[model samples]
Target: MLEVRDLVVNYGEAAALRGVDMTVRSGETVSLIGANGAGKSTLVKALMGMQPVTSGSVLLDGEDISRRQASDRPKLGMAIVPEGRRLFKDMSVKDNLRLGLHDAAARRRGADGLDLAYDLFPILRKRSRQLCGTMSGGEQQMVALGRALVSRPRLLILDEPSLGLAPIVVAQVFEVIEAVVAQDVTVLLAEQNMHRALSLSDRGYVLADGSVVLEGTGTELLQSDRVRTAYLGES
Candidate 1:
């Protein structure tokens, strides 16, 4: 559903992504696993049109959207739960979810989007009017996911969804992700936590020094000596 070709992104003279290439097939979850500075976020940002790509193309369903505005991408069926769960703390949970419907196509989905989000995370429906800032980390993450899902996006991009949660909370979040993938939404997950990311994905890519160093099926990478040594901390 998404294809990134010879993607290059830079901040001044510092390269954030150096000729990275990757693809996410429709109805499949693909993972990009790497260390803190390995350019995973850069790739996500570029694909979302939030970051300027120096030279490359971001194609969604075979059309080049590299030059499109960030706001435009969501309308084209892309939604992201950004790395930090950048929620509107002062707003109510339902309000945050409402913001996701800014796109015309998403707006057309109307109440169905809200129903889908609340269905995916029932806690969101229970706390519809609650302030986001007062929620727990896991609950806040649910709100973040709810916000994105309310857009009725075909492609869901989650950036480090497990970043600051407890082990139990992380497990809960992964369970929700599993449920989401089961709904037939294509997903591109960028995460530092190799095991969980690969475990949930169909295929995985290892990014290093601003480029893809390895690519394979999830189980293949899980059993790889290089992936184990580098990301999984195994022998």
Candidate 2:
């Protein structure tokens, strides 16, 4: 459903991504795993049109959207739960989620989208009026996920969804993601938690120093000597 070809991005003279190529098939969950400086987030930002692409093409359902504005991405069936959650801390939970429906078509289906989110995280319904900043980190993360899901995107991109949460909360978040996958939404997960990410993925890509170092099915990757040594801390 999404294809990235020869994708490159630079911050002035320093390249953050170099000729990266990857694809996410319809209704599949793909994981991008790497260390802190591996450019996983950069690639995610580029895909969402939040970062400037130096040279490359991003295609969604065969349409080149590399030049589309960030605001236009959601309307074209793309949504992201960005790194750090990036929620409106001062806004009410419901208001924050409502922002996801800015697109006219999504707005028309807003009620259903909201229902899906509330169903996925029932606590959200109870805390709809609370200020996001006051919620615990796990609750805040739930809000972020709900906001992205509320758009009913075809391709859902989650960047570092497990970052900064307790282990139990991380497990819960992944469970929610699993439910999302069951519903047929194509997911591109950029995560540092290799084991969890690959375990849930249908396919996985290993990024290193701005390029794809390895790509394979999830179980294949998990058992790889290289992956075990590099990311999994095995000898």
lDDT of 2 by residue, 1-235 (tens): 8999999999999999999999999989999999999999999999999999999999998999998899899888789999999999999999999988888967765558888889989999999999999998788888998899887888899999999889998988888788788888899999999999999899999999999999999999999999999988988
Q: List the lowest-lDDT window of 10 residues for candidate 1.
A: 102-111
State the displacement of the C-alpha of residue 13, model 2, in Å, after optimal TM-score superposition: 1.0
Model 1, range 1-235, lDDT digits (tens) per residue? Answer: 8999999999999999999989999989999999999999989999999999899899999999998999898888899999989999999999999988986788885558899889888889999999999998888988888888887888999999999888998988888888888888899999988999999889999999999999999999999999999888898
What is the TM-score (0 to 1) of candidate 1? 0.97
Cα lDDT for residue 72, candidate 2: 90
Tell me how many residue pairs clash in candidate 1. Answer: 0
Over 4 Å off, model 1: none
List, in order, the clash count of every candidate structure: 0, 0
lDDT of 1 at 59: 95
| Residue-level lDDT for 5 in candidate 2 | 99
